[model samples]
Target: MSNYSYPKLFLFCIGGTGSRVLKALTFLMAAGVDIKASQIIPIIIDPDRANGDVTRTIEILNKYRDVRSKLEFDRNKFFNAEFQTLNSLDVATGEGKEVGSTTAEGFRFGIDGTKEGRFKDFIAFDKLQGANRALLSALFTEENLDAELKAGFKGNPHMGSVVLNRFSESEDFNFFASRFSQNDRVFIVSSIFGGTGAAGFPLLVKNIRSPRTSLRNPEWIKNARLGAITVKPYFGVKQVDDSKINSGTFISKTKAALEYYHSNITGNNSLNALYYLGDTLTLDYNYNEGEMGQKNMAHLIEFLGAMAVIDFMGLEDHSLVTEDSKAINPIYKEYGLNGDVKTVTVKNLGRQTRNRVFKPLTQYTYSYLYWSRNLSSFPSNQPWTKGFDDSFLTSQFFDDDLRQFNRRYEEWLNEMGLNERGLKLFRLDMGHGLLHQVIEGIKHRKKGLFAKERWSFSEFEGYLNSVDGKVRATALPALFMELFYMATEKIFDDRIPNSN
Candidate 1:
């Protein structure tokens, strides 16, 4: 009615980093995307089920009102909306506290026949009132889904179902109907590696894509979706200092999601999903699984940049293309579908770093697809990684600090699901003279290099040249480029090698 169409945003998260990520993204949306204060809706997905330091971190973010206030667009106008937490039964409480049966502010999905399903990890949604269920269906009905799927949903109030696909049709339809009308985008911020996020995401995607067909009808689901964000897990494998709890499953899930996006969201469908990765230098004390750093701030800036693009693109007058085809502003369109972008940097850092290993390497990753013999790295595609830690980065109390950034990026990914393939790291092992001589026979070409002040691709002859009494052969820059790109989209397989 306002003579404008708004792209709705949504977010889902897993643990400590998840909540923080939501808050950071909200800040970006309010600032970068410039959504009106009254128009934005924020949802946080907490792992109210996990046990670990990571869990504790998530709890803190869940309850941290002070932190939420810091992300405000305007102190006077913004509604200090808080996160709602989810439970093992797939129930949610408005304030993000684990909803117990006794609380009035809590809400649950109606699970009728989930017990009979084949899914071992079947979702058990909390029950809702019959009247509320009917009210939902009557309110948000659309003709897109087949009548059979819609008729399959059961609005029964007492069933414990996790998979909405297990619920009756009307209630399921009504839930997302309310959501879509109220909001356009949904963010599911969680570790692709974790039980909750992995299981929850595919289900969430299904409902939004097919609104009335969800299995369970919850009390407070509001609308269908225009888009989704998928945050991939970024961390080190379990080392003496860092544990592999989240990273282990997160890596594989992230990979699977990347594959999913690449396969489905072909061509113009890619406008929906986006990825963001955290860095590797974890913490000492609390670095059990989660870590944060200056890289997060950089990542935040990246998403903020993305929000800017989305916002600018969404504006009708900004482009000459018809509303139906182009995505207003997309990296793919900027460089042409196969543009092969080098890098996009956020200036005004007012900062500097002592050592940047992945610069040239990361830069090389962006300009071309990556190749590695390691299967784990998902080589043979462009490889990328996230980070260029800001002035705020530090090694002391590193876990907690890095935790902040993890949450921020996590929130961004939750709102924008992974709809395509992207590599996050790229590297070229320019071995010593002997190894280099042998490598030359394979015809390894140099694409580019990330140096101080700019990202450039120069011709290299498989050898380092010390121009100013300094060995300029560094891999950090390249790694950075690869990591960041990984968070954005798929790597070129021709460059990425089959893994080790």
Candidate 2:
């Protein structure tokens, strides 16, 4: 590969699932997983203003931005990717004032008269002609036409289709198009079984690839390297008394969606690459159409979906687009394990997938666990954590920000482990001897007595001290992360399985 700068990746996260999976991708990127992009811009689209999952994801993204801004970036490979929002991009480029509110307020085109009225009133059904009213009545039921238009579409794709079709005319869309360059790429994430995602995915892609006379770089945006991952239903929900969502309808909805994609999306070559992932082994969550009740456990499928984004970024530009600026025999991918196992481990993953994720993930998780469990025991004289009052380890740098982020990261992994098709990569409950327990069956590897004795706090401190001269001396966050990377790589090299 040449030594040229990488292009920016524009990620359009379409709904609740999209937001959650973006959160997972953020954590993986922070841990030094290689994604072939210079920067990433995440745009979340969801009409549910009070969605718990989207809210939490925005909070984490903000915190990540704050922490990354304070670190040095000379030769850093981790936490070096730039993240931007449409509003921020507008300000940075001096295009205009902020186009929209923050991600927490949700992304939706303004409906002029729908805040305190029924959908029928907002659409002016009474003013339509006789034949038009009859046609509208044939397409939508009374409940669908008269439902309130404030909260969301209520798991109804038909309603979402009508509401979200106006997205291209919005100010945010204009700002995004203005900043898009010919070298940049776009990837979208959505769920085929939900309301906003099912409807928004195709609509957004259509607008991107459509010819627009108003936009500045319509042709560039149209022919940009495009990829998408449409998640099938992997989990169900228990039935509730008056719930608008029914888990029983997931399969039927997915079938309908696949048929639509076969006709309009895949056959027409709308996307350059597509990925599909779902599981037969699913866990039933509580029924929630939107809002606070919709917070879900992290799943293995979302992590794999995020991996699909990385895989897409790694593809060559020629592999995605032809000389004529059309999709060139677009690639389709699906994720799978090497063996049938209820509890997935590093050994169970395919060789290529394991090689990409296992070592980085393990190193990050182990370093976090070690610090959380045994930080007080490290000597105060060490170069990495020295100084009585000015040490980064003792200051709020670690206690306030890094510590809390590490706990959330551990919780995310633990939630995935407890869910269906469990990803049991680490033992989070143990305090003593936790480093050796990072991977299952790691302790049984044949090693000398000195190797076994090396899994101690003193050994970790010594490893950190030994790397002081090798790495560039920088800020506390950079030094701390470098130490963890060196320590974990050295300690786990012999015991961890070699890539096939």
Candidate 3:
């Protein structure tokens, strides 16, 4: 209904873990979860160009953009926040120097000269002679030297730290600095056990906290309210022969990263808020060093990590005090549930988490189910149609963009519901008793003892017919979204108990 009025939030997602967390964040936004930031600028920093997880997330983001661009953010707040890329913004560094054009497409940030070749080649190992060569050999194993750069660091944080140290000099960081205003905030998502995330998190923070003179708006860049979520080991991978990645090393790697962070990040108050999330009941996924085979399922930890982003943005500015580019009172946070169960429901979540997510998710679930079930059956002659025909329903807006978004949304829920420590929020397999048994533990409240206990698809259509005129969109796609948003909101308020 209205445009963004709040400040932008630059979200820096690093590595495979980062990509998964961002995917969770995107689904949460689609479900109309309240994120205080008006615009989210996702800067994905991953070297594995062919990573399936990253590829899938990028596809979802592009589809989200296409779908949300067609509809207004009405009362239901579905896809209300705006997202932008670094190149899309108007940016210039110090002395009117423009940031160089990037080679990375979409939301990714390309590291320099990493497109092809070996790790030894990237560092110019052949050029070294005598002690220099010997020192390099001492530092890196033969396998490390031969590791493919494109396949990622393969759990080698040492390699990642060296490779990612140049992040400050990247064009993407410069563009981000130029576009940043004083009120804008930054949040980083990474993992402590892996290569890219473990190394990139500290290096990225160092660059932001101590900006170079070449960067535009250096003071604002240095003093901005910063937050981050560092995911610990929550999943493992199957043992593969001759693979550089090893699940047995995760705990040791995490411990090392935590020590380094304590000295350089938390000890010096580098961030305003730091959120930590992990689980011991890990799921074993098929191992691929990187590339297309690296896709992993959605986990409860990633979902909670996304919630950390929302919580960070919602904090009061005064709580995050900074003096000369250093936080005065940095906050550390961890997530917990009301009960530790194998299958999670809305009621099992902590009160704050439940209050923030349950209602919005339920409303969107209702909208999705209703539209998926009844969209084709609506009479073309209804007043709500405005004389539109079946062609409008079959247009690209509905047939392509909306359809793809719906499919992905449904898959995300299913993935989380089937993963270890599953978040079983809804019973998606049901065909009947939708209003009464769709949600895992919550249900619609009946009007009276004698009245119908649950509403059928016919009753849902009747409610739609009653409210279609109230939606104020002229375009068919916008009208369609508005109708569902309004109907779901009303249905949630009138029928769903304990929704407040």
Candidate 4:
């Protein structure tokens, strides 16, 4: 799985929920989750250029790429999956033919004409003369016409559908099509009840399946192993008088979208696999109409939605077959927990989810705890610190990239735990029980008649010392990270019973 000879995956993340779920997927990749793709090209599609979720996700992705670039995918699985932006693949063509001239910062797929003024201005409402103007007015309300699109569609999918219709003609999308190769898969993440997502999902899929588009590799893209996750209303926004976004209309919008999808999306075999995820234990987040303030707390549903991506990648090619542009066996899936609870833990996750996530996440958490709390104050005599001097901590990889990345990791954990239907996977308040009680509901194995000795940071340190002598990497940063990775895996397996 660590080999680079595998197929590439083009992941299209569509809206605010799409950005948040992509963020969750990055966390999983950082933890070294077994994603089958050799390289992942994440194409974030959102018209809201300043969306807080998109900005934060793009930062995390760049940081992850920076950290991964410094390390080889040898023994360490952390950041093993390679990530690249669409613009970064412009050099892949051998004929000196360029992709396009879009000044995207290499992550976002910028749609043309979306950064401008109001909806009325975009549609040229003033130029329309008699019946055309009346028809437009009848279709759109006064508020919808006046709504500023610089932020987004403002919870109006109608506007988004119109604005995003020309997405296929954009340079970013053409670049994606040109770079697509054989066996490359595509996974789209979006929400079913929002503006950009609800409108973008069907349109994007339609363009991919359309033969009339002027994109490269139309045949390969049309029959590609495409999968999508349409996130339902898992969260709600607080009611504000001035805000156009209303949680009250979420379910109604979802129902309408579902009806359209049933007839056009699944009914026509537009996708090979479709995943649906929603949460009844809704959290009321602060209301913001698709701006920088639109950032919402991380939720368990997003994590599970990310799992849907991994599951799709892991599927056998035969399981997802297409004949005559129609699915022979279209797979529709939904997530289920072991129990219904407000606070979710590893124990609450289903067997497959637990088996996939429990150990990697725990090991990564332990690595974070040790490095953040004790790395700077390490004893000089320690075997792991022998070759590495004090200057090692000040290296850019350590001082800048890794430190900033770890801070984001901690923030992600806090946000997930603080959200409604919290995922309390790790006890962030480490002072209470430290390593032994860190992972919720997982107890450490004890030795001796008194059963007093438990797994501690000291024990973890010892494992690190032992593994330090065995691990090898090209750089000290990779060596350091891999040493902790190996030590955490070994210590967790030895000390935590039923860890397998």
Query: Which model, 1 or 2, shows the larger TM-score?
Result: 2
Give residue 299's error in model 3 in angstroms: 1.0
Against the correct fold, how does model 4 do in TM-score?
Answer: 0.96
Model 3 per-residue lDDT tens digits across residues 423-495: 8888777774556577888757876566665776656666677787798877777788787777777777777
The residue pairs in collision within model 3 are 1-73
How many backbone clashes does every candidate have?
A: 120, 0, 1, 0
Q: Candidate 4 local accuracy as lDDT? A: 0.84
In order, candidate lDDTs are 0.31, 0.74, 0.84, 0.84
lDDT (tens digit, per residue) of candidate 2 on 1-500 = 32137877889887788988888898887676788887788888877656777777777777677667766655444565677665555422323333333322232323334345666776678799889999989888898788777556667888778777877776667767777777888999999998888988988888888846476677777888999999999888888898788888889999999999988888788889999998888889888878766778888888888899899999998888833345778999998886777778777777777777877887777788777877765466887565233465666667676776777788789888998888787787764654555576455344576545325555566666776666663776776666677767665575564642
Residue 407 of model 4, lDDT score:
90
Which residue segments of model 2 deviate by more than 4 Å? 1-4, 74-76, 90-118, 126-129, 146-150, 322-325, 381-383, 387-396, 443-454
TM-score of each: 0.38, 0.90, 0.96, 0.96
lDDT of 3: 0.84
**Model 1 worst lDDT run, 10 consecutive residues:** 348-357
Model 3 misplaced stretches (Cα beyond 4 Å): 1-3, 92-101, 381-388
Across 1-500, the per-residue lDDT of candidate 4 in tens digits comes to 34466668899999999999999999999998888887888888888889999999999998998888898657898887788887776434323234665645678887877777888988899899899999999999999888777788878899889988979877767777778875788999999999999999999989887733466676777787889999999988899878688889999999999999999999998899999999889889988887789888889999998899999988888987766557778899999988899999888998888878888898898898888877775577779876687787888888788888889999999898988788989986776236788888887888547785365677777888888778888588888888888998997787778952
Error of 1 at 442 (Å): 46
Worst 10 residues of 2 by lDDT: 102-111
In model 3, which range of ten residues has the least summed lDDT?
Answer: 91-100
RMSD of candidates 1 onward, in order:
17.9, 3.4, 2.0, 2.0
